[model samples]
Target: MLALTGYVDRLSAKPGGTIAFKISSTLGGEYLADLVRIRCGDPNPAGPGLKILPVDLPFGGRFRGRHQPVHLGSYGRIETPAALADVPVLTLSAVIWPTLPDGNAQAILTVGDPSGDAGIGLEIGPDGAALRLVTTGGTQTAAVGAPLTARAWYRIEATVDVAAGTARIVQTPLDPARLGLRAATTTVQVTGKPLLAGAGTMLAATPGGEGVPASRHYDGKLEAPTLVAGDLDTAGVPAGRVLAAWDLGRDIGGVRVVDIGPGGHHGVVVNLPTRGVTGARWTGREMCWRHAPKDYAAIHFHSDDLYDCGWETDFSFTVPDGMPSGLYGARLRSGEHEDIIPFYVRPTPGKTGAPVLFLASTFTYQAYANHRRGNLDEGFRARIKDWGANPNSPDDHSDYAHSTYNRHPDNSGVALSSRLRPMLTMRPGFLTFNDARGSGLRHFPADTHLLDWLEAKGIAYDILTDEDLDDEGVDLLRPYAAVLTGSHPEYHTPGTMDALETYTQEGGRLVYLGGNGFYWRIARNPDLPGVIEVRRAETGIRAWAAETGEYYHQLDGELGGLWRRNGRPPQRLAGVGFSSQGLFEGSHYRRLPAADDPAVAWIFEGVPETIIGDFGLSGGGAAGFELDRADVNLGTPPNTVVLASSEGHGPSFIPVFEDLLSHVNTLNGEPRDRLVRADMIYADLPSGGALFSVGSITFCGSLSHAGYDNPVSRILENVVRRFAAGS
Candidate 1:
């Protein structure tokens, strides 16, 4: 346990007067043991109408244990008998605890007056003050004053003198404003049975006076809480220590500190050693005790491996025990990099619970290898995905994506060979592993419209950055009520699939708003890396190889087709293939009329539900030429519903996800948007009313466009809020 130290306000007051004290503490066994007690009780001497006053921690309640959960939150009291008239009586108490999840647990002290949960009692009346202690379930009273009413700091010490009483109450305090003062020479005598001072009113009152209800109470953040052994008068007061600045130097492990006084209290560490790290590698996620608002300063930076030390860093604060009241020298560094600079000193412990939002994909990101334009290839197609921001981009940064790349013609064009669609370019480095953030969307995920809306509603969020998903022992996505699958979630791993599949099956929600997803099987090898499956022979898009070589390998078996290989055909997510175009304009096939398309889901609430155009709907499959003909490629998962659809891609655009990693080999699945991208996916979760947008690909310009103030934006926003909030 990390015991709190430092000088408190000093006053020459009593029950009805001003008071203060400097306290010391240490660790015993494992719990925080009290070493020195100091305080200035009811300094404002009570003279009249002072009944019961109330005090509580700002946010809700607190825990009840020191170092361990065993016997936690036990409550109780302090005493003062015969409380002279309105000379108020005050007592002290609090709860201690370790961090959540144990393992690298550290002690944290939560201050509060435990309104009598422990075997402690008190009362205040007229005459003098008396203190009561309960042991073996019995009460023992200690008398200390005749009646005190004033304000001032008081130092109480109980020490060695056995013949004389142990408790020594003094009026001296230690304050930085008055640091270099000579230590007091002699201590006063305190005569009371086993414990020290205090005269409780009720204990000495003759009649029922204290019950009259008055208003004298205790207030303020007390610095030190402790317990001493004997008299300090003959031996003199203890000296205070001050030191700061800690340097852990290069890679280290389990570095801990402690105060060298009475109780041997271990100092609470802020920048902890990276967990699970050993022999040069780490197994667990890095953590820090930040005294600031939200931040993401470490990841990917040279300092991603560092930490800082400070309490609510913005505000100046005194150092706790074990260290001097200056900038303590404590830091974690690795060679030339300093991970934690200042470390952290906690705030006065309190935080509000806000709704949380998360943008993630189950199993996403991969390296693209094969290069072949579909029969509908515009230019160097797939090569131009994510707007060439892909790790696979050429050194010159030229983005040769295709026609539908986030709805940008230059991005979406696929270069053809002699019979070229555009100008096919070779990009061997193009990888999908860096698909987190908005990369997986075939585009970017930067959008102010979205961030503003979320912030206004008090939402905390996490983004799977544009790096390959590298989950450790925990499934980071599960904590969220919903997981969004961004546009074109073409890759899936067993872990990602397990987490998402489990999240939904556990009664979570899912939404599929993109097309032609989960349509291929893939593997990641150091060399010759590429997708392993293809569109179904029956419903997949037919690609025409240009002057370059065609796909070297042909996909066979179940996954090789669009039927999902296992369950029913994959188009089931949307219920119809590239055929249903009934909702609007030109079409290869019309919807089965209003009464026939049965997927009436909640997303359709407050809006008309329909499917239209199938061909040329912005390439992938909007309405054919924005006409109502294009189709929906990827279908819905279990418990999923469709709110809208289009047709015209071809006679066979079946809604199916192809790219995935399996237990051995299987099929399917899964969110961000904005920044920049060649592709994007937006969908609403079935639970918690969450909406997912994956990929940036030209979205900022779209949301920023004057037209965004229209229906499309409103509908999309509505869909996300409704589902994510479970409204």
Candidate 2:
């Protein structure tokens, strides 16, 4: 546990709404707590240093601290039914595809007492399948001598006859012809009496003794686990003797495991496993699980899946009746350690306080919460110490789990992300990279560049998050004259996309201040708050790719991947979509011929420099890293005008995969070099509404250059002022 760290239950709340804070501290004494308003967040000495300010509140005071633990892993738990408590004999069977066959002992199914010391379990070991029976006298085991192949389907069965004092275990490969595998079976004698089964049943994991968490988690897929009341043979048991049968394919969109047998012993899934996966009998016909649920009747369980910390609330705060809408945080301090848990306060419901609204990319932040890039070397550590930046990185900590951009221990892609744990990357002063030109910031801290500039310019604006906008429809944005985005609004839900598109088409000005906006499609469940799911399907600049038949999300049964593949490219809403990405470096943009048009020339009134944004805090230029461009074929409005385009990018940058049909050719027939550039565009809608897009993730980092008087800042100010006044 950290000396001081915590997280809020929600990202945003309106005035008169309450938010809870869950803290974890190892300090023996009391810790100081207070409220703060976050402004800059960046701590670079050359740029505007951290500008967090204190706010007086009644909830600020000293509080006692305690340590809280986070549990990680995924499994299924079913209460032991009356039929299973005192059976003469018991049989367990399941179809499994083990990803780590040679790994440590993994439990496929277990029927145990409350203490977990007295039970019968069917498990897979380094050699092969095994059955362990624990009684009052001693523990006994029976094993098959052969080894099981990894990533192969197999059927396992185990039987325990208490009165007969005998146990049996068997393993058979599903495809014996392909791997040259054979069936193996073993039967052993038992000497002690078995204990009553009143505790429960566990799948993919075993109970951790008394008053402990689950342990020995399985790393693979399991389907159609069933339990019988009598010692059954290979001939199969009668339907009336079936005690419980869990159909893993049922309720593919929820966490509950359905029981189709006569006994109603249903179970609930803990953490979150990969559902809608290919089962043992999957054919190559249907690609979607919704069309063929039987073929996708498997759940992939992992030992590192974490959905929540389940920590107790340390304190709670209710936004004052008239609190202003802005970014806020709970400052916690203990000894020499400190942490700030950030949250946003939105304007009161049914009230409009400002003409401009800043839409925070909370979904994107959660998607990259604890990303472990593995680039933190000695030089990065030295920079952190010298600059007094946040002293923690995901590379050094794995106890709280990682992001969807990372992979599991078995090398499978992480598909789900939860915001319940302390997100080290979202904290103030958190540096993502060690840059030679400027402070290396991304995501949360990087977005503050615009906030600091807005405060400095004395612009009155309200704040809202993607989650909030998703919960409330376009009505939440309909009252504002203009909506401005952050530096990297990449992850979004279909509802949020619909809201933005509707708002823009219905006479509302939209200023897209970032690149890679609305790139990937994400899913959310109302039953599971603060969690988001993504599937890196087919194509994109992704960290990992989803399996062939697992491209659909289990949260809402929606096909997951780039929005472009779903027929809703980012260009349709923002007039620009992702085009190129490269190392953390930048290049300058040149004014295009279309900028000279009298209708849009006013955007460059006071900016006389033809070559602007050459010097900035992020990679020393305004356009770098991920870039976007207007493509008419991909839904960019034909009436859109390109104001400027970036150039001079190093050879490290390349066009995205979606733009390439071959090594030497592009899908749109444009030169690869010309395709790897950002385009600044403007488009007018049918009403008085309009759009202004700057197609670079690093554009906001240039807003504070030359003390907030650079061309980038000037152009944005002109657009915001005009849009706010309804020009």
Best by TM-score: 2
Query: What is the alpha-carbon lDDT for the whole of candidate 1?
Result: 0.24
lDDT of 2 by residue, 1-727 (tens): 5677888889888978899999988887888889999998888999998998998876657889988887788999888753474687778888899988898888898887323566778888887888877777767766787788888998888877788888888888988999898788888887788764546888998887644468888999999888887755654443337888899999888889888988788998888888989898898688788999999989999998998888999899999878889999899998898998899999998777799999999999999999999999999999999989988788988878889899988788999999998998998889998977778899899999999999988888999999998998899999998999998999999999999999998999999988888999999889888889999999999999998888899898899999999999999999999999999887888999898899998898898888877878788789888899999999888899999999988889999999999999998899999889999999998776999999998898899988898899898998999888877
- TM agreement with the true structure for every prediction: 0.30, 0.98
Tens digits of per-residue lDDT, candidate 1, 562-650, equal 33443433233322222111111222222233323343233334434343222211222222211101113344333333233333333
Clashes of 1: 194
What C-alpha RMSD separates each model from the true structure?
29.6, 1.5
Off by over 4 Å in 1: 1-365, 368-441, 445-460, 465-474, 524-539, 542-563, 566-642, 647-707
At residue 543, what lDDT does model 2 achieve? 98
